[model samples]
Target: MTIQSAFAGIMEAIRPLYDAREASNIAHLVMEHVTGLGKLDRIIHKDGDLPPAQEALYQQALQSLLELRPVQHITGKSWFYGMELTVSEQVLIPRPETEELVEWILLDHPTQPAWRLLDIGTGSGCIPIALKKQWPAADIWAMDVSTSALAVATRNAGIQHTPVRFVHQDVLSPDASKVLPSLNIIVSNPPYIRESERTGMQQQVQAFEPGIALFVPDNDPLLFYRRIAALAKEKLEPGGKLYFEINEALGQEVVALLVKEGFEDVRLKQDMFGKDRMVRCTKKEAAPADTTSPS
Candidate 1:
């Protein structure tokens, strides 16, 4: 069958399950993954024929799409901060808002020699890998509680040739300090979504994505933030920065929490859609004491 005919057939098959626009997107994503043909290229090669093997592959991809599986899972890859990273059900798919957090960090701090960074709950190692790629001289460390997730992250780090120290440790545990030293920057896109909120999420997310990496108990929505912030205060050097990809619904509460924790100049920034999606703040510098008090 011609490439165009196969593409049309796949889209039509999934049309009942998704809106027209979403069906088109899924069709394009599947085609790109299976045939190495982008949307425009597919149109350009509409009349070109597909071999039987390629056609079979396309059909399988379409079947997955019809089940509403995420395109990244189907392709086994995801693009984040200009790098293609491997992904699986074990790790949370990197989101664009997290890229905003990375941008805020890079913009606030000038790259310097010997700068050390810590990424808590480093799902796919997106933030640390992006930082290492952008500032090769900076020292990077990533920690995660899930060994399966760490395996995927480590593989992506190697593929990207971005050197990072990956440690399998639970950040929520009380003795996190034992795992690493103080850092110049601490960043996380920790689990902030409450369990009750899960009902409102898409099927692709609620059904397929790992729950531990995406949720916090409704009663303690700020659990990870509190633990991470306390650890940052102890481990971060004076004047070091903290960054987070936050839930917009709890922006005010999160900002207040950080400020009360002695973070100075705490600020919430909006994403492309004008939602409060990122936060940045610095550890307060110590005040110098008077030296000539004795007479």
Candidate 2:
């Protein structure tokens, strides 16, 4: 079939599953991936016929779209902070908010002559890889509890040519000390979504994404935050920073936790929607030892 005819057919097939705009987006993404054509080029070459094999691939993509599978997964890749990373069911799809977390870190440490960064729960290595790309001189390490997720993350690291140390250890485990050390910065987009909130999420996310990477116990919504904060206290150098992509609803409580931990310059930053989405806390500078004897 001709390119125009194939595009129209695919859009019609997926229209029932998504709104017109979203369906159009899916069609464009699939077409671009299959044909490597920019939007203008695609329009200019609208009369060109798609090969039979390419037409079949388009049909398969439309079918997956109808099933509510995310286009990123269907495409097997995603762009984050100007780098493309491979994605799979084993990893949580990188979100734009997480990119903000990376941007904040880069802004905080604009020139790290020899920086060390730790990314807890580095699913897909999105945060760490993005940081490494932006600050090529930084020493980056990432940890995850899931082996499968680490595998995907490792592959993406190689693809992006961003070297990141990937450790296979659960940050929440009692024996985490052996695997962690003092670092210049600690950042995590940990699992903060309460289980009770799952019902409200879209079917695609609830059905496809890894649950362990996406959820927290309802009774302790700040479970990961508390553990990571405590670890940062032990491992982060004085004046180091901790960044998190937090739930907007928990912004106040998160700030309270950070303040209680003796973190200074704790601030909540909003995402593009103006909802509180990220929290950045810097450790207080160490006080000088007393020189004079107490009376």
Candidate 3:
């Protein structure tokens, strides 16, 4: 069958699950992966015929896509921060908004003197991997509770050759604080979604992605944030910063928690969509004491 016909078949099969535009994009990506051709080449050679073997692969992908499986899992590759990284069901697919968070970190701290960064709940290690790309000389570590997720993250770091330390530890564990080094910047994109909200989430995410990486109990949505913040208080040096990719509706609440935790200079920032999706705060440096004394 012609390449053009294969794309049409795949698009038609998945049309119920995705819109026209997204279906077309997914078809192109699947074609690229199976044919070893880029998107432009797939477009330019739209009329080209596919061999029986390649057509079989495309058919398999079409079947999966129709079931709402993410294209990244089928392709075994995802593009993040301009770098191709490996992904699987073991990790949550990296989102563009998290890239915005990484950009904010780079923009705010363009240059630093030997700073260390730790990313909690680091599924796929996308945040710290991208940060390490920007600051290759800085110390970077990322941890995830799942062994499978950590394996995927470790492979990504190896492929990028970024030298990030991948730890297998849960942020919620009692001894989590003892495992971390003193950090100059502690960043996290933790699980903030309430379990009750799962019904409202996209079918693709709910069915294919790791649920542990995406949700928390409704009664305690800020569980990860509170735990991580407590650890940051002990692990962050004076003037060190804590950054989070926060839920839009809970920005003020997160800021309040930070304030009650004695964090200073707390600020909420919005993403391109104008949602209060990013927040940051600093551990205040101690004020110098008076040296002069009465005679």
Best by lDDT: 3
**lDDT string, candidate 2, 1-295, tens digits:** 8778778987888787788998898788888877778889989999998887887787788777778888888889888888888999888989888888887777877765478889999999999898888888888999999999999999999998989999999988988757766798999999989998999999889988899998998899999999999998888899998999998889999999999988999999999889999999988889999899889
- lDDT per residue (tens digit) for residues 1-295 in model 1: 8878887987789878788997887777788887887888989988998878888888788778777788899999999999999999999999988888888888876644469899999999999999999889988999999999999999999999999999999998888869788798999999999999999999999888999999999899999999999999999999998998888899988999999999998999999889999888899987788888789
User: In candidate 3, what are the lDDT values of residues 1-295, reduced to their tens digit?
Assistant: 8878887888888888888998888888898888998877877998999988998898898888878899999999888999999999999999989999999899998784467999998888898899998898899989889999999998899899899988888988988877778999999999988888899988889999999989989899899999999999999999999999988879999999999999999999999999999999999897899899979
Off by over 4 Å in 3: none
lDDT of 2 at 106: 77
Model 2 global lDDT (CA atoms, 0 to 1): 0.88
Alpha-carbon local distance difference test for all models: 0.89, 0.88, 0.90
At residue 256, give the lDDT of candidate 3: 97
Candidate 2's error at 155, in angstroms? 1.2
Better of 1 and 3 by TM-score: 3
Clashes of each: 0, 0, 0
